[model samples]
Target chain A: MSLLRVENISKSFKTLQVLRDVSLEVNPGERHVIIGPNGAGKTTLFHCITNILPIDSGAVYLDGKEISKLPAHHLAHLGMSRTFQKNNLFGDLTVEENIHLALAAKKPYRYDIFSPLISRTDIRKETNDILEQWEISNRRHVKVKHLSYGEQRLLEVLLAMASNPKILLLDEPTSGMSPAETAQTSEMIQKLPRSVALVVVEHDMDVVFAIADRITVLHHGEVILSGSPDEVRNNEVVKEIYFGGGAKKHA
Target chain B: MKKLLLGVVLLIALVFAMPLVLSDFGINLATEIYIMAIFAMSLGLIMGYAGMVSLGHAGFFGIGAYTVAVIGQHVANTYLLLLLSVVISGLIALVTGAVFIRTSKFYFLMITLAFGQLLYVLFWQLKPWTGGADGMSVSAILNFGFGEIVSPNGFYYVMGIAFIIFYILLRLFVESPAGKITKGIMENEARMSALGYNVRVYKLLAYTLSGALAGLAGALYAYFNVFVSPDLSGWMFSGQVMVMVIIGGVGTLLGPALGASVFIYLQNFMSTYTERWPMVMGALLVALVLAGKGGLIHWLQHGKSLFVARKRTGEAVSQQPVKKGEAVH
Candidate 1:
């Protein structure tokens, strides 16, 4: 069954129509990749799905419930989590502190101001485990401002995953990374729990093909093609838009 | 934690022993300082933690002061007046915060400033209840069922105990999970929201909590000075509290309290030497800004670390070579 379904979602900024009737679906545990060129409305679509941007038309459903009009935080509470294209971290806080906050998001007493956070043994252990799993234990005490760009990106993804969402939306997770860093990030994403579905927007074809269970090619605010990697690779329209002509290429 | 506890104990001891050495005026000044510290600490909760730069905090402060003055006319009980003042101020904050938290950055600042000015005007115009521009004298605080606490020493002890309790509560609040989320919102609001935190709710809570604390301070101020005026609600007072927060250190739990002490001390000292004390205060503030960011507490912490490093170096060079190796890493 589809865990997340975007039905004909459309969004526009002033005169520019960014997402024009774009729709897609993600089955449970599917790694769906949305690949497009610049100005293809991929990020806008993600924003619409996450309710960061109000849609001009159409609706979004999460787990068979309509969530098009819900706020972004509400969507997050309903098992949807997302990372920004740019680094979105608590730059003033320590790495472990950041993870501790993320872990507190879904906890029962997130707003309890009287209880000491350090006294919560379960939360402390979970935070430490996440830091260790992400291999950022050494940098736990360091402020996020001092972290490398690659580390910040990794932390951003780790923060999204900390909420333990049923579906995660990642926008340009590997952007501005070195090849080695990209390879490491791809490995990290590939290792995410199978119970969590992923919808990734990417410009990097290598990472796209590496982790995608199904590929959707977007062009000029519309979905040009949606299929398996091999099918997208063979499509004539996708070939013209991405590779720039009728040149034959191995699938 | 041990150091903090020791400091608290030392502070409590010093406060209890203050009347033995200090004059009546000095004790009165100390009471004012305690009140201002509570006010500044409330601002710190919203400005430092939640990143909501409110310019109308004095509005809540005035609301608290007025609540005390008006209630004191009929009910002479100090505890009941304080409770009513806090509740009334919190309710006002809850109403204002619902609208205020939606705006960001400069807009939030401007709106809060406007709210404060509005209260100032209301206090000035409501002459029947508030005594308008001339202000009203507060009634003596009744000690539960005991006699009135009209003496400076009695008020000093009362304010001191209240300050300690509020400080401990505020400290516990900042160290709690809610406080952690507030700091998270300060650093990155969108990320907190994306993590499923209703950013608005946390901000509202911070706003309301800060308002309640400010109200508590205002109530104490009315009792301490035996006066309530429209000036208490003015933007100048809000600015003063904001300055106190910055001068002490923005995010540190005790920074606001220290800042208030420094500000009040400097004000008193400068006024004794010169009539143009505001200019001297401004110059001193400029000097502080030029010295470094993070205010006086930050410098104090930095200097202490430097001192500790020097002391450790003096004692450890030959005694612990392996420990030095670990320190290098």
Candidate 2:
């Protein structure tokens, strides 16, 4: 059964329509990859799904509960979390602090005054576990602003994991990485637990091929194709816009 | 742990020892310093932690002072008056923040300024109740059951203790995960929004809390001075709090204290001679910001450490390398 369903999602900023009639679904623990060239409204789709931007029209259901109207934080409480296309981590805070914050964000807290989170042992352990899994244990105390580019991407992924969301949205998770770093990130993505459903927007075809259980192709804010990885790889329309139309060369 | 204990002990000792070492004027100046510190901390809570710019802090202060004086005039219990004033000021902040927090930086600043000015005018226009431009005064702080807890020196200790408690509380808050989210809001609001953190709500909460603290300072000031006036609510006073935060260091807890101490001392000593004090203060503020450094407190902590070590121990180690995807600069 599908854990998340997005039906007829459309969004426009001013006169510019970003996402048009985009519908997709992710079954439980399925690794869903969204592939499109630059300006494919891929990031916009993620925004709409995560409720960062209001969709002009759409219906979103998480476990059969319509959640399209919920705000981002409320959606988080409903077990949805997202990472940005641009690596967005708290810069002044240490790596551990960032993860601790995401973990804490999971549990509800009213604007608590005077309570220090440092003393929370459970949150600390969870922060440490995510950092350890991401292989960022050594830089745990380092401020996020000072991390290397590759390391920052990993940290962003780790931050999403820290929230322990049932549905994870990752936008261009490996955009500006070196080949070696890209492989490492792919390896990390491969190791993510099967309990979490993932919707990933990636530009790298190799990484998409490596991890995606299913793929969706978007062009100009509309889903032109959705199928298994092999089907998407062979589609003529996807080839024309995405793989530079020389299907013979790639084949 | 030992160092922290020593710091606390030293602070306490200094607080208690001031009256013994200083003249009456000096004691008065110190009291003003403590009150101003509380005000500055309120600003820092929003400006530094939550990444908001507020220019109407003095409105909260004025409301607080009026609450104390108004309640003192009517009510028998000084403690109850203080509690009531704080609650009223918090409510004002909550209502204002709920609306003001929805706007962006420029709009945020403008809305807060507008609301504060409106409050200032309200106090001015409601002549009989608020005493108009002349303001209100109370004969004494009625302690009720406690019996006459009303003296400047006595209030000094009260205000001082209050400052110490609030400062420590704020420090603890800035280090917590919620505090971390606030800092995150400061650095990357868009990221926070996408990550399921409601940016505006967090900010509004910070503003309300900041205002409540500011109100606490104002209420204390009103009781200490036995006066509440329109001047307390003026935009200039809000600017003063901002200046203090800038001088102390925007984000650091001790920065506001250091900033307020210097500010209150300058005004206390220098105002005795000239009405031109405002110009001098403005010049000093401009010079400080132009230096492109954080307030004196931040410099003292980090700069002094650097000077002593001379980057000798690789002690200058920043926490981590700038994440490759997210360019630091």
Candidate 3:
């Protein structure tokens, strides 16, 4: 069975039908990349899968069990994690503090109010390990807002990874990064261990071909194609949509 | 750690030293400041950390005071009364905050203000139990096993001790993991939810904790003034505490306490000079808040930097002069 299954899910906001019967699946350890034009409802699909936006129709399942109605926060404890299209970091906190909060959220002691988190040696060690693992330990004390845009985006991914999730959803992870930063992020994505499945929404074609084990193409709020990387790259419909050959406007 | 210890030591020393230097009236005012400080600090918690700006905090404060006044008539135990004050207010906060946290920003402020007014009206109308608009005197003496604390000096010391204990408790809470999560929720609620946090729960937690503290402040005030009034629960009082939190600096625990001190001192001292004291107080608070970078705490930081700059200039006089408009560490 697929590790994450997004069954015939459709979402709408008022009159605007953002997603229409979107469906996909990810196997354990699979690198699934989602590519689409700007208005293809990629992020909306991410929201629906994570239960951030309640779907207008259909359902989502994790490990064959339906989770379409579960609260968004419950998705993390259920072995799923995600990043936003935009950097969603704790801007005022230090980088280490942000990591600490992410790690703490998954722990039973997140509700521990009497004891200071700094006194938790276990949490500190884990935070340090994750920070060092990402080579961000050197900038640990700097507040996230002070970090470069690349660093903030990197921290967003680091935080998502802190949960040791079974399936991680990254939404345009390199959206605002410089080219060098994008390459670095791609390298980081590649380096991510296979214990976790990756579902990435990326626009960079170079990064897309380099990392996508399987590719899913979305257009006009529907998946036009889902196949092997080579299959998706050679598809005429994708070529028309992406390479300016299509009669369809940039919707 | 050493700095923390020194700060505590200094606090303890000041608490002991202030009574000796102040007149009887000054001591009384200081004690009132302590009580207001607790209430203001509670508001500061939700405002600064949880990103909740409430305009109905005094409702909890009134609840605390009235709890003591109404319950003390039946229960003589002071400790039990204070505990009841905290629990009752906390539970009320839990229930009310459940509804309040659903609203954000200006709506939140308005909802809280409405809650405060509702309680204020309740107190005003509950004549037999609360003595209505005339208010009721607290007959229950605060007997802590050793002796009854009835004098101004005794109340001053007791309030000071209570304030310190609360300060430490709030400090520990802010440093706790839950507190960190609450701050994160404040910064980015959707992100927090995406990161596996029940954002509403944390917001409610902060609100409940804040309400309990405000209630305790009200209870303490009931004992200090020996009076319970509907004004305690009014929006005006809530608005006053919010101003205290804002002018003191919203984020730091000490900032609100300092803000309370300045506020209470100015109000008390100014009232004696003129009947237009509220106007003066309002003007002062507006000036302090408008000082820019954020409340009085930031101004304190600015002041410290200026002093350091002057000292550095003096030290560097014989050496190479510092570059103009150069960034200091």
Candidate 4:
């Protein structure tokens, strides 16, 4: 059974229709990529599925259960986590502190006021372990605003992953980075355990082809095609709409 | 940790010994200062940690004061009055915060201001209960079925103990998981909400806690002043506490207390020699702004670091100082 199923979702802002009858599905452990031109409603579709922006009409289901009207936070509680297109880090907090907050949100004692955060041995151990796993432990004590841009992006992904979601949605995780940084981030995403399914929206073709198990092309608020990378790379409509005319070979 | 402990111990010693050197009037003034510090610190919790700037905080303060004044006239039970005041203020905050937290920035400020003014008018027009514009005198706090604490020194002791207890509790809270979430919300509410936190619920809790603390201060204020008036809920009073929080230091744990003491003492000292003390106060505030954007606590920290650096180098420190909110990249 599919883990996530979006059935005919539509969204609009006044006369502008951002998403029009978009439908898709992802199985457990599949790395699905959504690619499109600027203003192709890729982000809007992601927002509709996550319920950040209420849909004009349609239904979203997780594990065959309807969850179209649930709030974004409720979706997160149901094992759906996402990263923002823009870096959405708590700038004033340290790296470890950021991971601790994400972990705390999942814990039963998130609202516990009397217990000092430093005294939570379990939370501290988990935070340290995650930081070490991400190889950012040396900068654990530094405020996030002090970290380099690549490191900040890494932290952003790590924060989303800290919740240990069954389904992860990453929106343009490498929007602004050098080619080296982009390759490193793609490698990290590819290394994620198969227990966590991924849905990514990316403009970087190299990263997309490197990490995607399947590709969905969107054009003018509609799905142009959905298939494996080789099929998507060979489709005539996708080639004309996305790659202009001729397909540029990628290494 | 040792230095902090010593500072706390010295502070306690000085508070305990205040009556030995000060006159009766001075002792009463000190008691007022302690109460105001609690008020300021409560506002700090919402504004500093939760990042919700409210302009109607004095409404909660006034509600607490009036609860004591009206109830104590017949009951004279200090403990019951305090409990009622805190609970009632918290309820009022919960109701208002539900509406106010949905709005951002300017809208929040206006709504809170409007709520405060509404309460002020209610207190002014409700002649039977509030004594109308003339205000009402309050009875002394009954000493826990023992006796009345009528002495100024005795009252000062009570106020000092309350201050210490509240300060410690607030400090611990700011270090707790809930407090960390409050800071996270302050930094980015959207991010917190997206991370599966019910942001509004956390904000409402912070608002309610702040109101309860303010109510605690207000209940004490009524007993200390022996009067309750509609002015307690006015916008000016709300502005005064906001200023106290800012002038002391917005996010620091003890900044609000220091701010309250400095503001009250400056007003007292300036009024002694000059009839135009308001102008003098305005000038001092402007000077503080020009000297540095960071308030007194930040200034003290910067100065101490600079002094240490100079002593160690035996030369003039020439590096550009790191500004607040700017990470050392």
In order, candidate lDDTs are: 0.87, 0.81, 0.90, 0.87
lDDT by residue (tens digit), candidate 4, A1-251: 99999989888999998888899999999999999889999988888888888899989999898888876778778888898898999998898889989999988888887767867999989987997898877787799898988899999888888888889999998999999999999999999999999999999999999999999988778887889999999987776776564354221
Off by over 4 Å in 1: A245-251, B1-4, B142-146, B311-329
Q: Which residue pairs in model 1 clash with each other? A: none
Model 3 clash tally? 0
lDDT of 1 by residue, A1-251 (tens): 79999899888799999988888999999999999888898888888898888899999999999999887888778989999999988887788788888899888989899977877998989988998887777788788899999999989988898888899999999999999999999989999999899999987788999999999988889887899999998997787777775354323
- The alpha-carbon interface RMSD of model 3 comes to 3.3
In terms of TM-score, which candidate is strongest? 3
TM-score per model over all chains: 0.94, 0.92, 0.95, 0.93
Candidate with the greatest lDDT versus the true structure: 3
Identify the runs in model 3 with alpha carbons over 4 angstroms from their true place: A248-251, B305-329
Across B123-234, the per-residue lDDT of candidate 2 in tens digits comes to 8998988889988886547464656666667766777777888876777677666676788788888766656677777787788788888998898888778888888888
DockQ-based class of model 3: medium
DockQ per candidate, 2 decimals: 0.62, 0.41, 0.55, 0.57
- Report the Cα lDDT for candidate 4: 0.87
The list of candidate 4 runs beyond 4 A from truth reads: A245-251, B1-7, B307-329
Query: Which DockQ value does candidate 1 get?
Result: 0.62
- lDDT of each residue in A140-205, candidate 2, tens digit only: 778889999888988888777776789888888999999999999999899999989999999888
Provide C-alpha RMSD values for all models, in order: 3.1, 4.5, 3.6, 4.3
Clashing pairs in 3: none
